[model samples]
Target: MNIITLYHGSGGKGTHELIDNIFYKYFYNKILDQQGDSSIINNINGRIAITTDSYVIEPIFFPGGDIGKLSVCGTVNDLAVVGAIPLYLTAGFIIEEGFDVNDLEKIAISMANAAKKAGVKIIAGDTKVVEKGKGDKIYINTAGIGSLRNDVNLGIANIEVGDKIIVSGTLGDHGTAILCKRQDLNFETEIESDCNALNGLIEEILNSKLKIRFMRDITRGGLATVLNEITNHREQGILLDQNCIPVREEVSGVCEILGVDPLYIANEGRVLVVVASEHSEKVLDIIRNNPLGKEAAVIGEVVKDKYGRVLLQTNIRGTRILDMAEAEIIPRIC
Candidate 1:
């Protein structure tokens, strides 16, 4: 009974006990505690943004965060990038039979803490148990709903040739952290995953007078993939300065040893922002003042190109095409 069993997933006493003891205990709220099939929320007005994402990260537990935290942050950041104020979340868990109860509790606690930090409530959730061999130790899916700011208008269509491209901080921290942990590679220095909810940092930028043309969280395919997505449907391309882009020395060392490009590596807490050229400095200052954006830098600018390509100007006197990754360099890294 200490560990999850098949019976816990059945709609019976075991299931009820698991819900009341774990899910409800950590995600207790006026709406969630009601234990209704669907939560009824009121006082919602204006535009609403909803985002859902699933987390199947291997090792579940990493140096800086676990799957639980990742699940909440993944969805919250998605909403934030769209100029939304996250309000509620629903978490779904698929746990393997024989998974440790303590580990499950730890994950639940992490989710609760992350939700609280992002100022969002977990209003509903579901848990299911699968055969040990058929499933990883645990997988998490989270859906978030938020209200959009009326003054905010952000999208790829708003991107122009003179717009500035800004990155919140250093790249490849999360990917490198997971890679090292998964491979059990011990280097001279340690790297921790930058898995965090970016709502607070994003809110500051949204509230300011800076013109935010477009924004996205640097996730699965890293900064390169995100920029490619922005330029995919447009006639403009992105030109990045290699020297201005922030990459930690430790992360650079790891990527160099592994022959991986940090541009294509994953990041959980970083954001890519495109803003008006006139407001670029103000936006950069705002982001740099925030703790999450201390390393924020203007790495690139949009350009009119026949093909919507991404080019990286190296610190040396060479330029290289930073194309979308043909295949996943590191899979299940988010």
Candidate 2:
């Protein structure tokens, strides 16, 4: 019997094998070895950006984008979240022995086009082949490096009480779309992953508001995980107005039916922003003008609280704890 099973996608035992055998080994530069959520590369002549991620979404193809397009955009968006001018990317591929060459060509072309759209280049890459069953059709690992604008200093440390929190667009599209594709679930409204590159939107916001405190792409763990990260660190609570949070009816219906929370579902093309209250409108305008952030909205605020927690105020004016979900959602989701 093949020891390989679906469990490999879990964040537990099988995930450890995949990371240890493939990811950590090949990506084992001294910098990544440090493992600080993201890689910290030195020798950056000026402001620098670095991000690393792996893509193993099931089915490889989706409604709006493919794994290839996702690989490029994902890297660019990571740098964008940091207020960086994304300029370069590195893609690594692990292909099973009997994969499709024509499809691989399509994947490569899509990546190239995505990089071009994001105004970046794929400067370096690596490829490997594995035994058929040991690997999926193909897995992509991407690492990106970009230069930050000298004037922009976006980070979690910039978050503060009274700062307004914003979401670039609607939520739960990515996870719902992927789940829909993998399973037989059907609905009147189809939700496509908001897969996109946000460098342009970031650039627009930076030009308009230099004081923008923090920004992050709502990726695997979605908006909730990101907000929790800040609360856990700053010892401040994030209070979100239920009405202010943007969600398409399709996405909301899907979540309600499937027992998932839109807040925790993955979002590919959305950004979470924390900025000064007074400048929130200015930042919002900059985002609205950009195509990537047209649906941008002010969703929440940072507040003084005894507990470092994230709370959601419902439409009924009641507050509930928005805790992180324990189960691995949409495994290999990134």
Candidate of highest TM-score:
1
Q: After best superposition, candidate 1 residue 153: deviation in angstroms?
A: 0.3
Question: Using lDDT as the measure, which candidate wins?
Answer: 1
Candidate 2: worst-modelled 10 consecutive residues by lDDT: 1-10
| TM-score per candidate, chains pooled | 0.98, 0.85
- RMSD in Å for all candidates: 0.9, 8.0
lDDT of 2 by residue, 1-334 (tens): 1233345444576546654564454334454455444444446568787899889977798877889989989989999888788876777787776677556666777886787788876655556667778789889998888888888877787778999998998888888888888786777766688999988888888887557998888987888888888788557899999999988888888788778888898888999989999999888888888887888999989999868889999999899988765684768666
Least accurate 10 contiguous residues by lDDT in model 1? 325-334
**Candidate 1 lDDT, 1-334, residue by residue in tens:** 6899999999799889999888899989999988888998998899899989989998799999999999999899999999999999998889999999989999999999999999999999988999989898898999999999898999899899989999999999999999889989898878999999999999999999588999999998899999999888679999999999999999999888888889999899999999999999999999999999999999999999868999999988699988898775898886
Tell me the TM-score of model 2: 0.85
